[model samples]
Target chain A: MNITGLETLVFGVEDLAACRQYLLDYGLHAAADDPNRLLALDGSGVELYPADDASLPSAPNGCQLRLAVMGVADEATLQAIAEELGKDREVHRVDGRLQSVDDAGFAIAFQVSRRQPLPLIGEISNAPGSPIQRVPNQLGVVAGREAIQPRALSHLVYFVPDLAKAERFYVERLGFRVTDRFDGVGPFIQPAGSLEHHTHFLIGAPAFMHGVEHFTFHFGGPTEVIQNGSRFVKAGYQAFWGPGRHIFGSNWFWYFNSPFGCHVEMDADMDLHDNTWRPRLAPLGADASQAFLLRRRDNWMPGPGTPENGDYAN
Target chain B: MPKSPTVPNCHAQPLCHLSELGEGSARGFLPDEDGQDRIFIVCHEGRLHAWRNACPHLAGAPMAWKRDAYLSPDGRQVMCHAHGARFEPDSGLCVHGPCLGQRLESVALHISTSGQVSLADPHLTCSV
Candidate 1:
């Protein structure tokens, strides 16, 4: 399976206007011809449909990821997937795309990658013994700036009632590998085509909670995550988690509450893993979570009798 | 500059002497009587810097694993044991981790001419 990465995600939302605005506020570019489709800065994006639309297929077992479409390296890979999937599960070719359903009931699609190489301006930083990222006049950061756009869809997380069965289907059938595991929790699985730490993370959860936990987009660096997160906060969006680094993938993250009943995250600087790397199992705890956590600051005032009294929250 | 005695009738209090900490060591300082608020002073590359002991990620939980052991194995950066976030020595800017653009709340400090390091202002507090 030469699955490169996430190509697009189809969302069945309740409110069209609100979801469109939410994607825009999150720094995604919506198509002018079809407002229902939202594009990331990289041109790949998400498509939205009405929740009760009959055209949509039923969810496998109450999952938010209505249809997860992935890009393949070439048509040969697509044909290969179609042939392999056709053996037992009924595979359909619709609009030049192969569609099938995994054992867990999540819809899957594969196509020759429409992904393009988008050139983005990189962000820089200054650290001890490292070259200065910004010159004297060129400031690295500013207060209350414009929204930061996301580069591409990084990954998605799913809550599954049967962890063992879900892991087996992805690994044995779809050619995904277990990059890491959380004891009694789940596994971080990556496809054979990409070197990203994990393209999909499966978490063990109750059947009632079986749905998409959250999905994330990659940004330039930590600066983008904080700046974008602050802008989202200022816009009155609730923050779910983050502004911290994860110990497993080593990415800077910030998660925000969405109207879709799931979290949306902006992440940067995730570690790249190869076959040479050995997967380690760690018990998930606060100590095993993020390296350091930051509080959401809108305006912080000092206590009485401080040096100077003003707002330092940004 | 000549050495001056500790000023009386003010909130500023001496934290420790510069010689007390090595080039890569840290100590936690409790500001209020409640003992819930903590500040850690670290010696990074022979310079003194301090930050709130709480990580910005985990609801302001203490960043250290054990008492005052904040440095990574290389002893170059201050690491939060809860999530493995690392911050710079002087600027307290998180170079990599969850709180990338966010900085540690820095407590103003004044080193007296007599080598006494004291809080520049005791009234300063990080709001939750």
Candidate 2:
């Protein structure tokens, strides 16, 4: 399978107005013809519908994520996926896309990728011995840069009841490769066509917990992640986890709670792996997952409000 | 006489006007250092119920998709959006998701005749 990565997700939300505004405030552009559909820079985006909409698929576990639409490299790849999945289940062609469901019962679809190539460079560092450096007089960050847009739909995580079955379906059937694994937890996988560590992750849980865990978009880099996340917090969204770097993918992350029953994450600068790499397995833990954790605080200086203990004051 | 259970020191903390929380609405309060609420109140079916913001599934895990969004979208159930655990709004019993069979920690609430809603005992964290 020449699947590139996630393309779009459809969510059935009870409060469509709030969900729509939330996506727009999170920097997604409202589709010109359809304001309810929002897109990122690469054209990967989300479509929202009322939870009671009959056209939407039923989420077995009552999750808001109703369908996942993946992007493949070409029409042949899409057709191949359709034929493969069509063998044991119903695969329908609608709106030039092949729609089906994964082994774990989540609705899925495939389309020939229409992602627009990004023209900008990622955030650059001024390491002493590094070959790439910003031109002289170029500031590391500009004041009030344009609104940060997520570059692409990065990945999706699913909580499944049968880990082995889910992993086999993706690996053996869909040709997704295991990039790494968390001991007693799950595998991080990427489809054969792309290698930004993982485009999907599966966590094993009981049947009652079967649902989407989270989904994220790739930002320009860590600065964008922090800046956009802080802006989101200031806008009254609740922060869940992150504003930290992950050990496995080396991506800077900040996760926020969404009206959807799962988290939405901003991620950047992930490690890209190829066939030459081997998977690493480590115990699931805070120490193994994140490089470090930090909390948000108000800006301060050693002036009027400084305590008698000075900088040492808690 | 049997010995009574020792209790923590308690103090009254006024929260908000009863009219502030509209029927079928929720709000969070007492933000900690990290800006997470330590407790929340829900006005459901014309009665005010309070619970610690912590979800039973994870220690100290605050339960809101957004600030004061402690209930599901339809205003029927309390939801810990951390993992989609749904609890009964009036009873605080976990009805779905990871913490099945568990219950939210409830706090006693005192509503004055003048419509002041306060913590019955702010320091007395009680289990449901």
Candidate 3:
């Protein structure tokens, strides 16, 4: 199977208006035809519907994620995926997409890739003694030069009751490779058609907690993660965890609570790898997971009464 | 920037009046240094109840996805948007999500006949 990364996710929400406003404020572009669908720079996006909407699939347990749509590389890959999944379960072809349920019972679909190319240049830094450098006099950051937008849909996470079964579904049936593993947690997986470290990550959990853990989009760099997160915080959205870097994929991340029944993340600067890279297993902890952690605080300058750390909380 | 997760200046502070909180609506109060609420009050089934802003699944995790928005979309269950765990608005018993079989810690409140509500144990708010 030549399944690509995330194409779009459909969310069945309670308050359509509030979720709409939340996505709009989260730096997502509005889809012209639908009031609820929001997109990133490339076309990967999320569509929202009312929880009672008949068109949306009921969540496997009772979580908010209704459908997760992955893009395939070609018509053959789409057909192949259909045949592979059709072996033991019902497969439906609705609106030219293959629809089936994974081993964990989450609704999934596949279609020919429609993601357009993003030609924008990402962030570059001028480091000492580095052969590659930015053009002369390009400042590191501009406070209000341009609006920050997510480049594309990055990855999704799920809380699975049976980690082995869930991992087998993607790794065996869907042609994904395990990039890394977290003991007592789950694995980070990459699809066959993409070089991204992992388009999906699974976390082992109880049956009642079975649902989407989080989904995130890629920004340009750590600057974008922090700056965009700061802007989001300024807009009154609640921040859950992050504005920090992870060790596995080396991606910078910032997570925020959402009405979508799970956390949403903004990430960037992920390490790309091929099958040549081997998977590693490590215990999940603050030290093993995060590279470092930082706290947000009011900007201040050193003064007579200034704390020794100068407003630094961590 | 939010201060430490501790509730600040809870002594003699009136959280909100009954008039400010309509029935079936939730409101949070006493933001710590970080502007994050320390406790939230909900009016459910014609009665008033208060709970710590933190969710049971994760320590110090605020229940709201945004400022003072702590209830589910239907205004029935008090929701922790961090992972969609919901609790009874009156009993604080989690009915769904990651913290299943858990309960949100309740905060005691003193509601006077005049409709003013204050922390019954102000010291509780100052810890976390």
**A1-314 per-residue lDDT for model 3 (tens digits):** 88889999999888888888888888898989877889999999999888899987778776778999999999999989988999999999888878989999899999998888999888988889988788988877889957788989999999999999999999999999999999999999999999999999999998888898899999988998899988888887888888889999999989899988889999999999999999999999888889987776665666676654444431
TM-score of B-chain for each predicted structure, in order: 0.78, 0.85, 0.89
lDDT (Cα, 0-100) at A299 in candidate 1? 36
Comparing candidate 1 with candidate 3, which one achieves the higher DockQ? 3
lDDT of each: 0.75, 0.86, 0.87
Which residue pairs overlap in candidate 3's backbone? B1-B34, B2-B33, B2-B34, B3-B33, B3-B34
Q: Is the docking of candidate 2 incorrect, acceptable, medium or high quality?
A: acceptable
Candidates in descending lDDT order? 3, 2, 1
RMSD values for the candidates in order, in angstroms, are: 16.1, 4.7, 2.9
Q: Pick the lDDT winner.
A: 3
TM-scores, all candidates, are: 0.67, 0.92, 0.93
The alpha-carbon deviation from the true structure for residue A183 of candidate 3, after best TM-score superposition, in angstroms, is: 0.9
Per-candidate TM-score, first chain only?
A: 0.91, 0.96, 0.95
Question: What C-alpha root-mean-square deviation, in Å, does candidate 2 show against the real structure?
Answer: 4.7
| Tens-digit per-residue lDDT, A1-314, candidate 1 | 88888878888866667767888888988878988888877767888998778777678443445888888899999988988889989899877779998766788888888877987666777666776466667878877566678888899888778889888988888898888888889989888888999889998876755677788898888988888877776665545557899999998988765655466888999888987778879998867878998865333466654333233311
